[model samples]
Target: MKQVLVFLTDGFADWEASYVCAELNKPNSGYQVKTIAVDLEPKTSMGGLRVLPDYDMSTDLALLDIPMLIVPGGTGWSDPINVQAKELIQHCFEREAGVAAICDATTFLGRHGFLEQHNHTSNSLPDLKLGAPNYSGDEHYVEAQAVVDRQLITANGSAAVEFTKLILEKLNVYQGEVLEQWYGIFKNGIISA
Candidate 1:
């Protein structure tokens, strides 16, 4: 089973990762979910859930099969004082692993120039620019719910469903009409017998 690491921090938007996580954690999905954080301390989500991470910045990545890193939007990502988050991202990128970010997490990636070479999306082009003063990827920025390019996934804060769908597609967890059915049920709240 491949391990999917999810980075958590104080004020993480729980709903942002809820759908994808739920699916990822389902039995026999060929993937497993693991929580990681800056430290071993429990992180609180925006929706008031306290999560105890299974791993921290100190964990050895060589021991894990990291296919992707998912980060939900949160208040902590924009801080100018980063711990090991940037290093982790660089490490993942170097290994050609998938990097997914939503909302402010996208801002952090933009701030650090992580989205420069890839097509990405965020809260908005203007907001991304404003949040990430170092960002210069306007030409690569796509205006959409979510975008996947060069193994990177980015989504606006409101694109949780889209984000999950894209992640599922990229991970090969669902495809074709099966993928569309999942999208329709979640995105449109439609259910068929």
Candidate 2:
């Protein structure tokens, strides 16, 4: 199975990527999920949940043939430690691979000029500009729950379901009516036949 690399760091929001990871594991979803960190040690989430990563950033990700990268938001994202995460996301983008981020993690992209040319959004435009003062994509920002520009996907913290739906759609894990039905069941509690 192809791997989707999810970057983890201290104070990471546990809710952002959970649905996407779970949905990607369904039969024929065409992907498996792996967590990566700066090191091999365990990291704690904002809610105090601990998770051990499957690999570290130094693990030669290119050789692993990773095609997708997911980054969840956290307070730690504003730290200098996020440089590693930025590098990884940049590498994925240069390779034309899929990149997804939510909440504050969007600032990582904004700070580095990644979103300067891509239509995107974050927890808020002001917050994103606060993190990356040089960000020039202000006019491209949308007020929607989630936004996708080519291989890059972004969302706010409260838009996890919509975020996951966009990722799944980008990955072709679900599409058209099937995707809508899935969203209905999960987002609205209405099961479809």
Candidate 3:
């Protein structure tokens, strides 16, 4: 099973990763979702859930071993102490691993120039520019729920379902009508018999 790393930090917006993590973590999904943090310490979500990370930054992982890195939005990204998280993200990117970021985490990526070259989206174009002062991807920014450019997947804060769809598509976990049905079920609560 391929490893899908989800970056977790204190004050993370837990719900942003809910659908994708749940789908990726299923037994038949052929993927293992593990939470990573700067340390082994338990991190609290914005929703008040405390999560004990499975791995820390110093833990050695094989190059390109990760298929994707899921980053959720949160106020924690505002904490300078978590800047070390950038290394893990850079490592994943260096290995060509898909990077999925949503909400303010998108801002974090924008601030770091990750979104500058990729077609991406966030909570708002103006908000992204405001949060990421150095962001220069205005032309690449798409006004949509989510945008996937190559291995990079980005979405707005309210587009968890859309975000999951793109992430699954990039991972090749689901395709065609099956993917759309899954989207319908979660996005619209319309499960077919």
Candidate 4:
């Protein structure tokens, strides 16, 4: 079973994070989903919803050896806890783990020097400089969705529901009827069996 790790923090975007997990957890999807947080207790979402984390950051993610990591955006970017979160992200990058960050969290990738010369985007471009081939769009999410350059895969924001769908596609879950079903859901906002 392939595993996906969601890096959760206080004020994380609930819709983007939870929706991705829920979609990937579909029956026969072959993905094992887990949420990791800086703390062990439940964390509050930007919408004030509480989300229970499956593990703490201190826990060795090596056991699961996740193939992907999803980072959802929120005010947590400015919090001090982001320091450690950034380190973990760097570690994942070093290990060749596929990473996706939505909204402001995308800035974290820029800050860590991980996106140099790679096309990328964030909710708001920060002053922190990077040399990546970045682009920003007006849409809530970049329609092109996940841009895979080498080992890096990035999505602009939540506007592109296809972001997670691309991950599933890469994992070999979004094929044939599954791909069609995902497209229908994106176009009509409904999922059919």
Cα misplacement distance, residue 124 of candidate 2 (Å)? 1.4
User: Model 1: per-residue lDDT, tens digit, 1-78?
Assistant: 999999998889999999999999888678999999988899999889999999998999889889999988888886
Q: Candidate 2's error at 160, in angstroms? A: 0.2
- Model 1 weakest 10-residue run by lDDT: 78-87
The weakest ten consecutive residues by lDDT in model 4 span 131-140
* Clashes per model (N, Cα, C within 3 A): 0, 0, 0, 2
Candidate 3 accuracy as lDDT: 0.91
Deviation of model 1 at 43, angstroms: 0.2
Question: Model 3, range 121-162, lDDT digits (tens) per residue?
Answer: 999999999999999999999999999998899999999999
Q: For residues 63-156, write the lDDT of model 2, one tens digit per residue.
A: 8777789999987887776688877887898899999999988888888888977889898988888988989998889988999999999998
Ranking by lDDT: 3, 1, 2, 4
TM-score of 2: 0.95
List the pairs of residues colliding in candidate 4.
117-132, 141-159
State residue 182's C-alpha deviation in candidate 2, in Å: 1.0
Per-candidate TM vs. native? 0.97, 0.95, 0.97, 0.80
Candidate 4 lDDT score relative to the true structure: 0.70
Using alpha carbons, what is the TM-score of model 4? 0.80
Clashing pairs in 3: none
